[model samples]
Target: MPITLPNGITAIELADDYPALQIETADCSATLALNGAHLTHWQPSHTAHPVIYLSPTAILQQGKAIRGGVPLCWPWFNAHPTDPDSHPSHGVARIERWDLISATVEDGSAIIELELKASPVIEAHVPFPFQLKALFNLGQTCSIVLETTNLAKENIAVGGALHSYFSLSHIDNATVTGLQHTPYLDTAARPEKSAVQTEGELRFQAETDRIYYGSDLPARIHDAEWKRSIVVEKAGSLTSVVWNPWIEKAASLGDLPDADYQRFLCIEAANARHDTRILAPGSTHRLETRFIVENLS
Candidate 1:
């Protein structure tokens, strides 16, 4: 029988039949789908395409854009230009399948918990053998929770992040505020420079790629043309990443349209290189990020 959770949420039990899970919230207003127990689609509003969608049903990675969707990429942020064994551009978890344990729907949202036990497939590529639990909560205010437990006898080195691709009407008319006087590594220029201080809000004048480190301030993106601003609050993770491919790099992504990059920006919470964290046996760590869409008009 299908289990009916709180807040008008329901979970279909198909663990023995197939690798699909469905989560529905109260009022039957919103629904999120999972394949192989990993988040696939987060549809907030019924009259739309979707708020979040992950491509390749099995991989749980590679999110393709549609409308106002936010793609969730985990474990790693961007390419480690210096390291090759870091596991793909981000990490191995994105491509691996996760197993669902339970779910709860409450307060106009649904929270589904998924777990992954280390296996030969993951161990072959990733040296660390650890247990991972990803709690994905879908609602009007959605959040994907990531928790890692060190199960291996030896201490392990791990790096992780949540990459959120926000949809915007226009990039030129948007300004990001919050990070002030924060230090960041500017990846746009050659020789790779770092900023000790920022003049003001970071604006997308051209192709921008910078990783801001050690900031607890909340950041916001104001879309002047759309009359809407998105506020982001971070907990557990201290670093913030802002990226816009602009013109040049956007053209290289064959899956993206020529004008797509101008309409979206990636504000990610990441840990890389020097910021990487390690976990010892019987230890655990967590990272969380929240997005609130508010009306500016």
Candidate 2:
């Protein structure tokens, strides 16, 4: 069923089971998929370029991740905390179809909520069961709040992130701020992982993958070529992962263009690695993040 909204836009079916919800608000325009409650696009109407970067070769399938956009990583982050060989890369949340809970336009902003309940398939991968909900606000300050509550009788440790892929004019033309002196482990570094302190505005030169901990400051990507800056702020998150696969690694990704490495940067608001959250039974943990775009002056 194609549901029409108050703004006269319809959420059309993009797949047999997934409906791609196109949103047009006064502040911006965006698209979301019910599958994983994944946000695929978001651009402020005033901006010249798309704020959220989506890969050109991104595959839109039922079970596969869309490669780009804002993929929700939950229950676990990266390889399984316990089972690295067999579990999903991020978690079970992004691969499962979430049920629509509500959708409404509030003060010219699109507010949508989607829920996911645990079942046999999820149980097979994760021992603990959970009830999850994702709230999206596509407007001036694009926001996403992920709520996960443990359903089992015992406490459960969970990790998640709003893995945001941001658009940039070019890799060399951008620099990251607000994470100065922050401690991070460079997972892609050679001779085992290297723990280093960030100095000044971080610039990318190669395949970069770092897990930053103990930081609550807003990370800003200053894009000189695009003439804009992206500010990422978060709450209830203690970890941030910054990455950009330069040339060789980008060519190896089947769902991403080879040159896309110069076009995007990922500054994620995450509770990952050592920043895992523990939720008691019937208690919920909310991971919230907001994206604010500012023109460079």
Candidate 3:
């Protein structure tokens, strides 16, 4: 059976694998996978390429993390810093399904909300009581707001990222701007090294994994070959992670095509490292980011 929202958004199971919501507006269309409340695709009517990228062989199984789009990393990131081997990487949010709360259309845009609360599956791992909600405003630009509320009486530590994979005409033709003069941890370096970015624009040549600190500015992806640029803006985040699996790493991944790394870049809005939040009981923290594609010519 198909589920229809009051604003005519359609919810249907995809490939008998997982439930997804479809949103169409006068300006754009998007697909949201409920398993992670993940925004898988977004395309403005005027753009030639999609603003987001989804891997061709991405796994859509119920408890598996889809390989692309925006995967929500929450509660903790990458792994628990103190107990790396004891916790799941990127937390529990991306592997669980979220409930659609509402979907509405206004002024040629689609506004949607999805919610997730702590359950037995989640408690079995961390045992922290919390409520997570995501609000999406999709149109010519796509914006998302993730709010996490602590339900327990004590304070809770949390960190996360909107692990966004953006499409590019070619990795060599893309450069990310706005992180100039920022300091970052080079994760690809042996034992990890800290460095300052002196280059005004960051270009890709090899495997890249750097966590930039204290970044509150909007970053821009200039795709010279595509003649377009993608502007990424964010709030409530003090860190930005830039990554690309360049060759050997990409080949080892089962879900992503080896050569697919040449077509996308991951510039994420994150609250990791020294910026992790400690939420007081009854308090809420919202992490938001917006993506807008513009023609260069």
Clashes of each: 2, 0, 0
Model 2: ten consecutive residues of lowest lDDT: 1-10
What's the TM for model 1?
Answer: 0.80
User: Per TM-score, what order, best first?
Assistant: 3, 2, 1
Name model 3 segments beyond 4 Å from true.
Answer: 1-8
Show pairs that collide, candidate 1.
51-69, 75-160
Between candidates 2 and 3, which one is better according to lDDT?
Answer: 3
> Could you tell me how far off, in angstroms, the CA of residue 182 lies in candidate 1 after the best superposition?
0.8
lDDT of 2 by residue, 22-76 (tens): 8887788889888778888898877889998889898778778878899999888
Order of the predicted models by lDDT, top scorer first:
3, 2, 1
Q: What are the per-residue Cα lDDT tens digits for candidate 3 across 105-188?
A: 888788888898678878866667888999999989999998999988999888989899999999999999999999999998
Q: lDDT for each of the candidates? A: 0.62, 0.86, 0.89
TM-score of each: 0.80, 0.95, 0.96
Query: CA shift at 174, candidate 1, in angstroms?
Result: 1.4
| Model 3: how far residue 58 lies from native, Å | 0.3
